[model samples]
Target: MSIPGEGHEDVRADEQKDGRKAGGYGLHERANPKRHRVIRLWTVVHPSVLGSTTLTATASEAPLTARLYPRNWRGDGVPSFKPSGQKGWPIRGQDLVRLSADYWWVIGVGVVLTLARFSEAFLVLKGRAAGLPLALVPVVMVVMNVVYAATSAPAGALSDRIGRRPVLVAGLAALACADLALALMPGLAGLFVGVSLWGLYMWLTQGLLSALVADTAPEDLRGTAFGIFNLATAAALLAASGIAGLFWDRYGPSSTFLVGAVFAALAAAGLTLRRRQA
Candidate 1:
């Protein structure tokens, strides 16, 4: 009998060992508790780098089957895969037009309203047909602002539920009516009531518009979008208020509300476009 060469047999045995090393381990082998136990406490969390190193067995390609050896000879299994990178983000932009529209439209409306107060101040004085009472007009403004702060968002949600068009139209109409009420109402009490109504309406529409923007804006771009939206509104208000101040002096109380109504009515009607979104 010819004896196998010493070098050839050793080479074959080494090949066998390599092959066995590549072949994967079964769960039973991993779960075997009776054998030596390994408590691998990972000190630093290494992100899972997959794609290249992550190997999957192709049934046909590896006819020369391989086995996975433990990192050490003790046969402790490989650690489970961990996902890398961060989580996903939220919705955004012109696609969220309802939100953007509300932000712009409401801002336009609000800017006009905020600046118009200065105009309303002189008008209220002149409307008194007396040299304006310093206390009365200021008090009206303060109370109106308080009401505005109190009532804004619920009204917006209400508007959202009922339909933006109707609420907007009604707010504009009420705005017009409120001004008329103030223009016509002779007593301080009556003026108070009228101004209060306008503030309440403002609260509703402003909050509603903001909510619309928040709801629509994508998670990442929200701060930028909302900032721009508000800036636009403020700019418009600045123009309106400046021009409106002159108009207040020129045409007096009647012009202020009339102009406000014209703009508001246009905006309210403008909301008809949103019907499709509903």
Candidate 2:
């Protein structure tokens, strides 16, 4: 007898209905064939480090048992079994269509945000182009990380008090400003300013996207929802980096940043429209 579910809880339930005790279905000497019995002795012949031959033997009588569960179960009471409020594999495509509009909007915003921001390596190239010395280029990363670490917690807290949309919009605007600063300004000062702004953008956006995913996903499918959203954003990032690189190769560095700014602006606008509609 099986249930249309997989998990220790469902397994236990099925076992109870079938009058089987917990752990009763697992391996025991009586249930297993002789061939499955544990080996008592094994020998190894090898040369020692000094090149002398050595023979080693070990013996034990301990029995090992492994429990196996059916991957899929069927039972008359399956329809009565409540959902576990946890994600499961073999999910269907229709499950995605069942998500709320708000959830889709959040995913859209995340995709657009990812599409706008290429790899941070572009920041290093921008700094180099602005006349920052090669040896000191890593300082841009150091400054950006310091600011991101410091602000992330506080910004997350602020979002909890206010809301997600406002903070996300602010983050997108900050990213656009950062792109402009990197494109138009020159020198170490511009690099630091742009990097700092990028950090602020990250602080505002990153955690919020995860939170939005949690808020919108169905109780039983939250993990699947998160997986889908993350996969989409990761794909967007690849596209963004490739497009940025192509633009940088052909049209100069400023064109790449300009395109990023346009994408960010578009994301912010889309988010704003969604919020108003909500």
Which lDDT tens digits does candidate 2 get at residues 186-229? 77777788899999899888778888888888876887788889
For model 1, residues 1-278, the per-residue Cα lDDT tens digits are 33476687778878778777755344545666444243222222232333323444343232221234233223233334344454564333454563455456545645554443334454355435433376555676677788888876477477758865577667666776676666666666557777787786676555555555565566645675677667766677677777666766898665766666566656655555555454
Candidate with the greatest lDDT versus the true structure: 2
TM-score of each: 0.50, 0.67
Tell me the TM-score of model 1.
0.50
How far out, in Å, is residue 167 in model 2?
Answer: 0.8
Residue-pair clashes per candidate, as listed?
11, 2
After superposition, the stretches of candidate 1 with alpha carbons farther than 4 Å from their true spots are: 1-132, 145-160, 163-165, 184-190, 276-278
